[model samples]
Target: MDNAPLVIDVAGINKRFGDKHVVKDLALQVREGEIFGFLGPNGSGKTTSIRMLCGLLTPDSGRGTCLGLDVLTESAAIKRQVGYMTQRFSLWDDLTIAENLDFVARMFGMKDRSTVVDKALDDLGLSGRRKQLAGTLSGGWKQRLSLAACLLHHPKLLLLDEPTAGVDPKARRDFWEEIHHLSAAGITVLVSTHYMDEAERCHRLAYIAYGTLMASGTAVEVVTGQHLHTWEITGTGLQGMGEALRALPGVDLVASFGATLHVSGKDRDALEATLKSRLRDTPLKMTAVPPSLEDAFIYLMQGSQDQFQG
Candidate 1:
């Protein structure tokens, strides 16, 4: 993996919409055949950054190559080789599943369109519902159809923006299975998602908050990089305990997880001392625990300065 050639390499990229600098100086490297997860809060420039990487939106200032083509000078060629699935369902709902795939193949000027569409349908398990109207399909089916369409032209790199949003757990699982299969076939994927479980599935991931890249690494590396010490407390007054934990001197994160509260801080000694003192006479059970990926995510997000906020 260390020796894999980078399929998406860009640096010093910036984009602005009027006075709002949407994406700050951004730098990223995604290896070929790697599933690179892009994660961030809403309005954090995930979409904008994805567009810039895939050639849909030019960076205001940057120099790099995506698919060996210059991002600034060869965006048209870059668009041809990349498959981009938008956040929303962008296909024509009036068309049938088969019709949608066939139309996309046509738009790409693919040879033997019928054969291509047939294989796509069979590959995605859409052959049985080829004639079903896209609008009548459930969210899962629609998502499958969207993925089939994206794979029609056999793009080298796939840019998926929250492809599993609003789908059932089973559907999301199935979709990830397909993604892994594609990665195994040497198709690089750059996917943006809000789900922590989904982020963990990626081979590597980067967290961006408000146009700034906060962290990029494997899940374990990211979790370790935060240097946060965490404790899990279970008690009857977890809600009240969480509030009090947030007010302590060293506590930086206090989040509720079901019946337990995950309280974390950068200063382990201070956090432990404060908690031990606060729960000295209480019945609450406290145990030192490793911080979760979501803990690191929230920590990174909280530490970032949102450009929109005054």
Candidate 2:
């Protein structure tokens, strides 16, 4: 535990409800100042794992520490040192932007709430709309406000669940930019997102499904480590092309990449053989391509929900 290369260190973690096993033998090591993306389908224990890391929820089995504090025994202490921004907007809708920040600062018992609120508003570029009501703000502004409120307490770790669900692309990029800034400032952030572009921006990632840890690494490493091979076939009539590719042996994922269809599978030789064999009758040009992260993700989740074999 002392030598684990992570700010949040846990091993063989397990949890369950009355009937359903929500988490099983979960393990993770998230480094300090790293943006670790927790990728998974809904109800797949992503939120439960984040809770275990920060000590908000107790695991039925296994052990770990967060910020050097005992995850089970020092949960209250860990909670005080973490900032959690849930998927839903938790702030008061009628409060002004400045009021929300001020309230949050006061919640942390800061000596100078006004000063902290002012700094947070200015830092998040919300000073211009500091007086605007939270209910009247756009999704981007609401996202900014949530971030500002979380930062008001100045916690070391930020746990964000689907932080960019509805914001525009520019706003999402801006949010990610701010996350990187926080990482540079030595603040560790664990974010769960559905967007692939956002996943690529993380320092490293862990994919979970059906209460199991599927994969974890940098984007390139995760994709390459899957040993998946892809083929980009360019031609018309792509609507039915996916079916053809899926029917071909060894092909697991057939997704469109703009005007081309990216066909991928775990077995390289078999996949390539299928692509070369199937395209002989069509004008589609077949070329081997590298598997993208999304392709690997699709492959990883193929049979995950089939049944509880473990």
Each prediction's whole-model lDDT (CA)? 0.91, 0.86
Task: State TM-scores per candidate.
Answer: 0.97, 0.94
lDDT of 1 by residue, 102-200 (tens): 999998789999999999888877788889989999899888889889889999999999999999999999999999999999999999999999999
> Where is model 1 more than 4 Å wrong at Cα?
305-310
Look at candidate 2 and tell me the lDDT of residue 163: 94
Query: Candidate 2: how many backbone clashes?
Result: 0
Candidate 2 C-alpha lDDT tens digits along 242-271: 876777788878888789888888788888
- Poorest lDDT segment (10 consecutive residues) of candidate 2: 1-10
Prediction-by-prediction clash tally: 0, 0
Candidate 1: C-alpha RMSD to true structure equals 1.3
Clash-forming residue pairs, model 1: none
TM-score of 1: 0.97
